[model samples]
Target: MTMDGGRALVLGGGGVAGIAWEAGLVAGLAGRGVDLAAADVFVGTSAGSVVGAFLAHGGDLEQAIEIMSARPDGDPAARPPKPDMDLVMTAFALMYDTTLEPREARARIGRMARETPTDGRGAALEEIGRRLPSPKWPDRHLLVTGVDADDGSFVVWDRDGDASLEAAVRASCSVPCVFPTVEIGGRHYMDGGVHSMTNADLVEGASTVVVLEPLAHFTPRDRLERELKTLGDARTVVVGPDQAAIDAFGVDVLSMRLWGPGFRAGLAQAPAVAAQVQEVWAGA
Candidate 1:
């Protein structure tokens, strides 16, 4: 379970705001220009998978933050639920918008989700997935988790690459019925967080496990820790939004506000998170 002296960082799941909160942590790392040790396996579920893929490819912390931190200029409520403007979004815009404002991004993702398969492959999906992580590289031990919608089982990675890899990621990021289910190898899939927020079972061969979580403060923090304790033989650390921050988000059932402009307050905490990461690394 432990990588002995090695360390692994797992970006935890968040729907809309979770990815933004993770972006703040990444922004902090970018500001410092620091790097974690080698042989670290990065595991992410849902929004975490979207961000973790970049870090796995040795993505720039600051640049990644800029993209993940996308937000509308004013009231999210003011934004169009169904815009009268052009539905067609450029690749760059679609890339970030999907997670930033998932409602809108869903339209963009919807275009590729049901793409026509050519000889058992969805060409459009392949093209979109390939462009996700900037400056792509090989031999990166990356795992993007998803769920098979038919069976409600996890569709995490194994020998992933190209459009198929992107398909897996899109499936993991897909919101059930919000965005259409994505097909890979003839099977449809949905978000992996439907099972567990952390999905720490993907963590292996690391002595230290660092998780970035954006769950509400009212969530069972201690019980989650206990569950991680049983997952593997490693030191686990979970960092997430505090009670005050969660209260500020004012989460409510079936509300778009939580994942919208209200999430900006969540981004405000990035700097402090960087400090905490630094301190944790120092102790390690």
Candidate 2:
């Protein structure tokens, strides 16, 4: 691994957890004698918690909060720097639970369609205007993106009924999208339900890297290992849900469970990771 000033890529940066990770990563690079640039896909609620976390993590929290509360820009990317990392975060913002009962996923989609496009994305606003009720009972769905349009560049979408919305948002976003995948004991796996991007596209200078994180919904440890073997000596870092899990991956795993303090420790160790990057290139 060659270390110069390569950009630090952050995937799944939509909520407080994402912001915290970005901040920690930034701080880590600084500690490692590296100048770090960062980005993410915000795809969740516009609640104060997300903004507050960004502020606490050294971002322009106030501005980010304002943009989210008011859909002032036709394109979210046009907004000024708030929570400005060295690089730009892209795609969706945060995830929210649209329905109380996830089993009734169809009903939740109906509600999303009924709501107005308070945020200014043309396609999303138009879709909501033409929505119809689902022929199902109390619907439940997972919200991978939020309705809040705080970021000027991103076109936020709700992953209510369609799990594929995750991929759609990734394809549309301005910044490279990072979709997490797991590897265990030299094998890699991607379940149909898990959101992932192709390495072929990314390797061609797409500016995206997928970092596998812990999921409450599913597990595929054996598959994860197979996937890593395919990388064949690519510089990869395994950020553990905790320090112990790091050992299981046989890679450097930064414990993510220690939200505030753990992040601080990780930030202090960034240079070690950045030093390993072989190239320093900019993304479009």
Judged by TM-score, which candidate is best?
A: 1
Q: Residue by residue across 32-119, what tens digits does model 1's lDDT show?
A: 6434423267777777776677677665544544443343435332231331112222322443442455334433344444442223
Off by over 4 Å in 2: 1-8, 13-18, 38-259, 277-284
Please report the TM-score between candidate 2 and the true structure: 0.32
- Which digits, one per residue and each the tens of the lDDT, describe model 2 over residues 1-284? 12132222323322223334444554555455543323222212211113222322344432332333344345442232232221112121111233333223322222332232223323321221122122121122112222211111112233333323323332222121121211222321111121221111122222333342322112334434554455444444434233432222222111122245424434544555565432331231
Best of the candidates, lDDT: 1
Regions of model 1 farther than 4 Å from truth: 1-5, 30-39, 61-131, 134-138, 158-163, 216-219, 231-233, 243-267, 270-276, 282-284
Each candidate's root-mean-square deviation in Å?
Answer: 9.9, 16.7
lDDT of 2: 0.29
